[model samples]
Target chain A: MADTNETVLDMEVIGALRALEADGAPGLFAEIVELFLTDTPPRMKGLEAASDAGDMPGVEAAAHSLKSSCGNLGATVLVDLFKQIEMLGREHAPEEIPSLVSKSNEEFVRVQSALLNTK
Target chain B: MRIQDGNDPNSVGEGMDRHLARYHELKDSGEMPGLSLPEPGNRVPASSAADGKLRDEIIVQLCEGVADERRVQRFREAWTKTVEIVSANRSGICERFPYDEFWSHSLACGLAAHALSKQLGRGNAEEAFLCGFFYRVGALALSCAFPFEYAELMELRSLSELDELKSVERDLFGMDHVETSHAILVDLRMPDLLCATIGELAGQADGGRSELAYLVLNAEKIAGVCLLDESRGDEEWSAIMEMRRELGLERAEFAELGDAVVRKWWEYGDILKIHTRAVTTFLELDDTGITERSLLGLSKINAMSEYGSPLTVLIVDDDPTARVILKQQLVKVGYRVLTANDGADALSCALQHSPDVVIADWMMPEMDGLDLCRALRRYEAGRLLFFVLLTGRGEDEGIIEAFEAGVDDFFVKPTHQDVLIARMTAAKRVLNLRRQIEEDHRQLKQQLCRMAELAREAKDAAVTDSLTLLPNRRYATRRLSEEWSYSERTGLPVSIVMIDVDRFKMVNDTHGHDVGDVVLQRVAEVLREATRSGEVVCRFGGEEFIVICRATTREDVLLCAERLRSAVERFVTEGLAVSEKITVSAGVATRDETTGNVDALVRAADQAVYKAKELGRNQVCA
Candidate 1:
């Protein structure tokens, strides 16, 4: 038995892949994971720099990008976390951003490993 | 404020400027509120260099309020650039549009209104900005619609008596600029709240002045003092004082706000290529509220009237005298009218105003009305701008060219008043039909988008199993033949695996169907994970399943079958209703030269599955 927090497969992505039977081709699930892994780092840095500079517009742009991408990849927990950061970037205090960003980074590592394990 | 028909025509502006000076004499003496608006003279185009393209930053700056979070953004973007280009270039207007004065004044008034809107805490800053900038739009539409008579009215600027311009407009065109503008904006589908607010300036609102119009009036005068001739300072100061008394705006706070707007304009004025006579320091001010041009609260958008809005008519003729008579008749019978001197002016006015019908002289200078009709057709497909040429040439060949060039209907020159009016009335039906068609098309497109979404959902539902959300037996059955045909073409053996939940009925009996459902779902998940990309798995009714393996020989099929059997055995049933281990039996078969058909191959897999079940559960058979 696997712990809920451990790198276990998400049935949703596997189910989506099951529907698409393109023989001898790399599945959509792998490509989506690869895309998310590549897309998250620059965005995380952008959120950090924008928060540090007190640039609400930049923070909002970066947060919005991260939120949608995470939502599309079925990173629901990370998506919710990113949505909080995005709302903050739109209004209210930036002081709370660092903790959220770190939490997002930690959770994404689990998501990344779990997605890779499915391969 | 009303003006008595004094001998001096200049008294219209002169009387208002002198209203406070002669307060006792004029306060109780004046009859009504007249058109005391400042008429900005023609621009002396900048000597250095002039360009055509209106840069994006100007809209960002000028429409700062209106553009910020308003849903009317597409209109805002287009309107801002239209305003900027009309203000920036002198030649463009002299050629196309008839009225070229006071646009800079309009922008200044908009800026001042935006500044004041912020000060007053009025939530609709962008709307105020747009309303202020475009306050004088009615004046332009009227003057352009009847150039000759309007030019004569311009000479009457000294007569401080044309209190609403409604009377002078009534005498001449039978309708004033305010009425003309209301119809124009309504046709443009402008926010009704905005239209209602501007209606205050027309002195036609049921109540006195709307709060928005009061702020615009004060801000406009303040801007006039700062940007216009220094001689207008006394009038500006008096106007500001009166607005302060009326609106409760204090001088010091307003001075700060007005100065801020003037200073802000300097920072980006040159970049936007805006033409301005130095607006040095803001005059001592008194006002409230700011109207950000593009950013306004979305709440208060008047339920736009799509169908019943009045139609706009553009009158184009080289003879300004003839245009005046034509405009008077159109305005008399209640039509929102715009007029131009030639084809150039007519085309520009038609595009900017988007009038429902264009009435022009057939033989005018620089692109006759027929040629103008052809040029209009190039703008957007499917004849939105209706063209009617007034031609003396009723010859067969000329009429053919006019019709070929897309003239809707024609009025021969020196047309009878009743006859032309009747023609206009008939044209109204066609125009209304076009509007209805446009409304229908817009609704149909939205319906198509919804239907496409429903179709996507339906397609998803059709292919997936309800319980586990895996492909069902129907999907697997379809994929089997597809794989078999592909295998035949490539000479690659196709394999099948018949899977069954070993003693599924016993699991259900022991733990109930809830636990049975969980067991079946768990087994499906494990099988899905074990299978590679080229394999298809389906629930073949209760407890039974199938997998189609493409381009795979018997050996690979056997390995895949053993993997699925082991995976189902290892599936975790902890915390589930099932107490016993969950497992599935798999039987593998492959297509070969000896296999007669896909049915024979499937029968072989069925026999293999029964053998696996007979060989005691939780084992693979090949």
Candidate 2:
């Protein structure tokens, strides 16, 4: 469980985010964490729907959006899974995108708890 | 400083000649570093036979970079040759010409004119550039023509007005720089419009000046501010502010133009191989108290947001978090921020606020960023809006497509605060320049329309009677000539019905000129209303009128004259107690073979009027 947690979340990226706090007001990081928690679910759902319908462009766009949101909060493992899904969609490999999309959802669950703890 | 002769080293003192000779000896022996060129007296002709084309090409390149092609071509040949002539005799010209100050000022002036012309969108950028460069050529020509006298005259420039300086120049050198510049331009066969515009700068007041002339004037003032000493009288900071207000620029934007002028001046100096001194920027001198504000979070925002009406930015994203974060960043940097959930929402928000900039995410549900950009561009106000697209993909093909849809800039998300702030600053600058230009264009168009209306009024006043509101004698004569020529061409006899108010002298003596004027006005109205469209009735002079009848014979004119006489008799003059009834004596004359010309016909009518007066008052005669 500790090894999986180490791979899933990047503490150094969270420290950099903390440095962006204006005179230690404690709003930017919480705001970004809240945004990531709200923004990723709908995008992950759209990525699954696009994979089911074989909509390559839609899958690419949704995965790309999710990847950017996750990367902002230092969800590196989930970001990597979504990046692979985005590439599969871009390259028209619909067969491989669904597996990666499911794996991304599992990793996103862990990133959400880690972000909630950090907040 | 007074002008110096470069060739005469002994002019400075006795020991300088020996040092100069020794320096030249070492220079010729290649022991000392020097430019390898012919001595002052040993140079080629003004044409500079060798490397002339290369020199012209260099000048052409420099000019092309500074001004537009069409305007540059108008004076390109003459301008290049003048530069060559000056360069060939540079030492001699430098002896008389205040080379350093004049060169720097002229270069700055030309650059300012080019930038100003483009900014105003007047389509005369090149003409402005040429005008600015040659504006002070008269001083150079004067110096060359009368070096000693012109040098002494230039000393009075700071102390005297333009007219006073001209008078002094006339006393000393027999002519001033304005006249000399005019003569030089005419000799160069410059465009008549350019010559006339630059020649009219003799008067300093801006009233009754052409737009091109004003452009040159302002360009010179801008150059004065840029290159001259800070304490110079004509180039004071207040003068720049006044011109800025006249140009319809906010304080911040005017400082931007000043910075551009200085930057371009240095670039032009490099191209022309002239030395440029360090310039204190207009922005630096303009301490608007914002710079003095403490560099804290909220205080810095307060100081910056107080500058000249804060610009608004509309942030659009399907994601709520992206929208909120971006809005917060923009608001932190003093931007008035509007938020929207999607592209459709952004369009409505933009319409309500008319935001200066729109930043929207590309991948939206119904109307994406590209579609939103296209939609905004369809509106008249939206066409000027600065649109930035936020995309996750920074693909080249996508950027090209986005640009085709009218996106001004692009930002990738998740956005960095620093990058967003930088983009906002750029947006503010571009928007300010565009708005200033638009205001200037609108004002210039209105001024042109007003000037056209005033000119029409002046023309009408010149040929119209002041009191009677009828055509004056000058218009009558011109109409008579036209009618006479028409009669000769078509074999039609034209008739003239001359009218004179009866007992008009008594009316003036009894009342006053005011009542007499009213009497004449009443009589003019009678003649005007009674005459047909084919006849032209004019107040020939005081209490006298003439009706020109085209295609009318003598018989017809007699009846027309009788009709006018009866109409005047019937007109009861109101508001005049002394002269209640106004009547006129009418005389008719027709063009025939006996009356060979217009003057003879007019004379025949005059005699006929006298005959009517002698026979009986208020009667018609032929």
Candidate 3:
């Protein structure tokens, strides 16, 4: 199902991109987006599997890494969502993980589209 | 050019231009040393007192073959004595003034002048030394003539604004310090070379004041450098950088020389008990800096400690957050950490930085981790780069692909910092072990080189005194016997001058063996320097030397011995460990019709030396 409420590209990322360029690391945002696209899917898959298996540590670790990837790419909302999932996993409470993870996957899809278009 | 490389991370390109612009702005704004550069000519480059002895050593190195060591020593003594006389005379009138401080500054300038001249190969060390020390005569005269007034003036304005002070002095009393000093030195009948040295300080570049003159000016600057606060070291460094370039000095060489100068300055203040303003502590030689850099700077630590240094880890991930987490984890364990974004940057950074371990994300754009590994393998197998590829996909095919692409380890999507560090720690230990082995291999290579050097030296050194570096007794005997046979065949006379240091045992007893060793060495140098072309000088035994003067009779032999005696008498012990003068006595014997063999000739010389010793030491006897 298409999420109508989603904004593809986050405007906040433009500031981060400009800051990176000013730091003499121009063209870094594209590489960061590519890494986010490449790594998030597997990490998201790990969180889903670990949550289903009730492997709390596995879910926590996967969510944490995924959070890092999103944060770096300036996906602030996604990062916040992943942070909640990671905290829940760390507490061994997988009950709310299903809803959060589903939203995460949807957000990932939007992020992917936004990143490819930005590229 | 040597000071900063183009590719160096700490390049002074843009930053230096900014600093230069700021300096010019300050100049234009009349902040400091503006376009109103005081009067006409600049102070000649001269070394100051703190490292004057070290500068003299450098001068001696330059004068290796061109100037006689004895003559150089004499010149240095003359300079020292003249300065002592001038200052000693000033002590009567300027009793309350800080003469030690003033004298220390003069000494530093002289040494700096000497070192600069010797380094550039442009001017004479002697003239530079004389010019440097005596140039302060004007200030000394002012102090001596008008003690209270000079003291107030000096206290009001330190030497940093020496030119300003001079200008002020002229306003107060029709003559500046330099002018007064010049007049005083002229009245003292200072040599023309010394006078010309001071004159050149006022003279401009018609070929740049003989390079030595520039050194006199540089010495003044260097003395100022030693007086600057550590926080303001950049001023001194900027001046040194300019000097190094002008003198065509290599960066390392200049750094080494500067270190010597600073250390020598510190020592001078320590020895003289002069209450100098604290000098800048060079960062490279700082104890705490060394410890800190050893922890962080792997490459430098590798050079410093030949055994082992920390292994460098390069974390290559396009995700900046991932890279940061990984780098922080690695660095926490004391590994040197570097980071790169994506595969291309990783590749370039890896090649440039030469990290020991490289961890890369598998699916980066342009050059993915797998492709990066393969390219690295192809580019150089010697990388020992210990490639660890991070893949989100744990499928067998992807794993197989990673191996095919030459990855050494596989790390899954989420790397637990603890587990990663544990594995990397193991990797680091192995790398350190490898480095140790490499160090041992290098040391072994150096040992082989050293053995070769020792072998070469042994060939010559076996017959040479290790202390005085003169021909030993065995060589002397052999040389004399050979000369004797030649003399017998040619019917030409062969004479020997047997010289011994006067009361050498007392010298050893008074100054300890170290000073005794130096005295013996000095005496050898004097004898060697005094000998004629055909004379073969040798350290026959303890405090005794034999010179084989070929084609010479007793008269010629006595003359040679007398010259050597006079030279030894003139040698000063000011800079040496022992502060007492040393003398030598000699005896001459020639092979005439009555002489039996080389042994008899040696015996006769020995007997004559004893007679000379009995006839009051420091005389040549035949």
The lDDT leader among the candidates is 2
Question: What is the Å distance of residue B400 in model 2 from its true position?
Answer: 1.7
Q: Which stretches of candidate 3 lie over 4 Å from their true place?
A: A1-119, B1-77, B86-97, B203-208, B231-233, B263-278, B281-622
Q: DockQ for each of the predicted structures, in order? A: 0.01, 0.19, 0.08
How big is the positional error of residue A15 in model 1, measured in Å on the Cα after superposition?
Answer: 62
Give TM-scores for every candidate, taking all chains together and pairing residue i with residue i. 0.30, 0.37, 0.30
Candidate 3 chain B, run of 10 with poorest lDDT: B287-296
Q: Is the docking of candidate 2 incorrect, acceptable, medium or high quality?
A: incorrect
lDDT (Cα atoms) of all candidates against the true structure? 0.62, 0.69, 0.64
Positional deviation of residue B25's Cα in model 2 after best superposition, in angstroms: 99
Top TM-score prediction, candidate number = 2
Better of 2 and 3 by lDDT: 2
**10 residues in a row with least lDDT, candidate 2 chain B:** B288-297
lDDT at B543, model 1:
86
User: Candidate 2: which pairs clash?
Assistant: none
- Listed per prediction, chain B TM-scores read 0.34, 0.36, 0.34
Clashes of each: 44, 0, 28
Each model's fraction of native contacts = 0.00, 0.34, 0.17
